[model samples]
Target: MGSTIFTPFSQKELIPKEEKLEIYRRERKLCIGIPKEISIDENRLCLTPDAVQVLVNAGHRVIMERGAGEGSFFTDLQYSEAGAEILENRKDVFAQSLIIKINPPTLEEIEWLQPNAYLISALQINLCSKEYFKKLSDKKINAIAFEYIMDEYKQFSLVRLIGEIAGTISILYASEILAQTNGQMLGGITGVRPTEVVVLGAGIIGEYATKAAIGLGASVKVFDNSIFKLRRLHTIVDNRVPTSIIDPKELKKSLRRADVVIGALPRINQLPIITEDMVSTMKKSSVIIDLTVDSGKCVETSELTTLSNPTVIKNGIVHCGIPNLTSKMSRTTTKAISNFFLSYLLEIDQEGGFENQLVKCQEMKQSLYMYKGRLTKCTIADKFGMQYHDINLLIF
Candidate 1:
């Protein structure tokens, strides 16, 4: 009774005032670095001159390795005009807090990173190993893979753009190969049979390849294991192209007569659609562009080749398995990639900073494959036999 009498009115019984937290918006000044790519046949640049200008205008420091953008036809004067400091020594560029590039850093490049630095580049998962993760972990670096970067719609924006470029280039390269083999054009000619183009996989690359092939007046047939993707491709191509399930008999029959065979199959599957025996049946001098070769060959006889020596004759078929076809059109690809990255960097400024943005943006969080050197992507971790940590747990 004495305690009850001494107790004041409980705050829970009364209407309590709402406690408001103060929100501070401070400009995040980041030292962003662009390193020259030394990987085999990588020509794409992460940012363009215009992108550098925008970042510089936002009060962020931009450091570029001398000649970093030369592969994409961007001059040092252009980047300098956009307010970037050009450093001749690569180690100086790598000293920046944020590193961006096209290919995943080589082990030597990773050694150049400072502790807690952020790395943005392609993951190249098939080329990655446990040692890669261990190296990044040892250095306590954060890594983001462009392939995992997503948009508001949960679609892979970078992958789709690159796929479109690859698809268009694939058909064009095939046409060149066809001309090299026999002095024949890819499309229909009066009284001449149109080039028979058989495309495997009806995904993004296959869709664009079909469009390009059909536009050039080639007889195009697309095959996919997924009826949904095949149907989707049919609608995307205005219902004109022939679409079919990947029946072995029909596929082999097509292969025997096809002037160009495009292997645009998705990388999820490790098995090849066209085996050695099927490839051998193809017409001599036929061109096979296996765009999916990087992940795993879509044609059994196709081997990974560098841009310098991109084609090999296997069973009389010219197999071109260049992993990065987009690099052939480096300028256009660089512009597209720069646009994506500019928006991303601007968002970081608007959202306060990377850590805060990761907390607020689901898309940003999803794109982060590694945080503070810990493996955060389950698929990559599992594939490389490394321990996986939930990014959310590590972030907070």
Candidate 2:
């Protein structure tokens, strides 16, 4: 009765209310490392001198191992002039907070990495063994594949760019190989029949390959398992190119008359679309360029080869399965890669810090294959027979 008679307490006094707001963290300066690629066929560099300059201007430290940019034709002096420290010992470079390179680090290179360092590189899963993942996990490193990195639009930006380059380069390489193999031209001449190019798959690589082949006056035909992709490719190419479903019989017939066959199919299963028998039926001395060799080739005869020893003659056909075809234009690819990395790193820095960015950025989350010591990608885990953990669980 006395309590009921007392005056009611104010809401502030009852609840002890206090104003609170989210904290905005200060931007962090990163220490980025660029190591020289030891892989003979890897010619592209992840970051350019101009990109280093931009990072340096933002107060980040960039460490370049001596000759890190040599493959891409960017001199050490260029990187130095742009405010990067050129270290003689590569291990010292790997000690940086982040390491960015064109190729994934070898086991020896991984040994030099500091614990929990951020690794940005291509995860050529075809080349990696289970032991590779174990080593990276043991080090508790965070690995993000540039190839797997998605943009705001959900498109794989670097992968598509590289595919575009590889597509064009595939046709160019076919032209050279055709001339050297049998002295045949790639395009049609006046009053002469046009060279026929059969492109497998209707992805980015296939579309660009068709464009390049068509531009050179070659009649191009595309085949894909997906009718939507075939239609998309037809529309993308202005509906000028012929498209077909991947009918084994039709493909065999086309290959028999094809002057150049470009395999651009994404890996569906473990096997190639074109059997050895199919390859045998192709015109003698014609070229086959498999742009998807990194994933798994679409041509049975194609083997992964380096740039130095690219083409292999088999079944009287020139088979070129050099996966990193864009590496031939190292400087252009380096610039393109650098453009992506500069923007990405800048965004990370602007977001305050790596952990802060991780908390707020979906793109970075999508890019990371590993977080801390756990495998965050199901594909990698399945490939290696390792347990998978969702990256969201690891971070948040």
Candidate 3:
């Protein structure tokens, strides 16, 4: 009875006490690595020279593989000038604790990673194998995917930015190819008919493509299976453009007169709505830009057109299905990506690095597909037939 009555809590209940504070651990100098992209389709760098400068100035160590920035016109000297150590050994760059890239690391590159290393890159899960993920788990890596990275509004920050670029460029490239092929302009002239632009899908890529076509004075007609998205796109453009559901007959009829067809459909169904027969119905030399070719072909006849041979002719229609459309504007895309990453790195720095940041940031947690060698993304796990672990369970 005496022991039960002499408790510290019983005494504290009657006594005034100071509040306890959460003291964060000491901040550590982050060592980040940038490896040169070996993928032919990926020509954009994750961080630019300016971004490296900011990180270096903040007492962080930056290691860059030699020739890492050449694709974006950022020379090794530029990165060196920004205080990054230029490492000729690719393996050495990958040895750092944190690695960033435009593309997901190749299976070989994953083997180069050290145990418990942190990775930030595009997670093109479509291109990855079960073996690739197993290697990551074996190394006990922490991986974040750019596609899952969210902003304050819960929208994908990096993906939307790249989608915006892709949308605008689709119209621009179409106009250029149209002008060169048939000497027809995108806009209407006093004596000439208005250029008819047909756009598929009403998502981010399609929305901005419609806006761009309208801005260039082209007559834009948008089609989508979703009435809501179509209606939203109509309102987004001030109800100035005509909208329709993706009816085969109506779409085929419109294709006959379309001067440019922008294919912005994603691979939700994995089947092309616009068939080869429908593509054949379009006007000869009409430009078709399949922005979602990387996901899957929206146009049945669209082919993989590389920079060397930028356009392919199928059924007498000019088709451009370059998957890495944003890479065409490499410098601009790199800078935008770098700006987003700069703030992300700085926040992690202030939070005493990845471990503490993992506990605090919801976005960071959401972006991670792998946490300390455990699979956290159900979508990826399901696709690859792998065991899934909850990030909440693993992080703590």
Please, what are the lDDT tens digits per residue for candidate 2 over residues 211-290?
A: 99989999998999899998787677864688889899999999999999999985633788999999998889989988
Among all windows of 10 consecutive residues in model 3, the one with the lowest summed lDDT is 1-10
Q: Which 10 successive residues of model 2 have the least lDDT summed?
A: 1-10
What are the lDDT scores of the predictions, listed in order?
0.87, 0.88, 0.88
Scored by lDDT, model 3 comes in at: 0.88
Q: Write the per-residue lDDT of candidate 1 for residues 98-203, one digit (tens) a residue.
A: 9988888888888999999999998877667788889999999989998899888999988898888889999998898789888879999889999999999888
Every candidate's CA RMSD: 3.4, 2.6, 3.6
Candidate 3 ranges with C-alpha deviation above 4 Å: 1-18
**Where in model 1 is the C-alpha error above 4 Å?**
1-19, 22-27
Q: 1 or 3, which is superior by TM-score?
A: 1
| Better model by lDDT: candidate 1 vs candidate 3 | 3
| Cα shift from native, residue 69, model 2 (Å) | 1.4
TM-score of each: 0.92, 0.94, 0.89
**Residue-wise C-alpha lDDT for candidate 3, range 96-166, written one tens digit per residue:** 99999988888899999999999999876645779989999999999999888987688898888888888
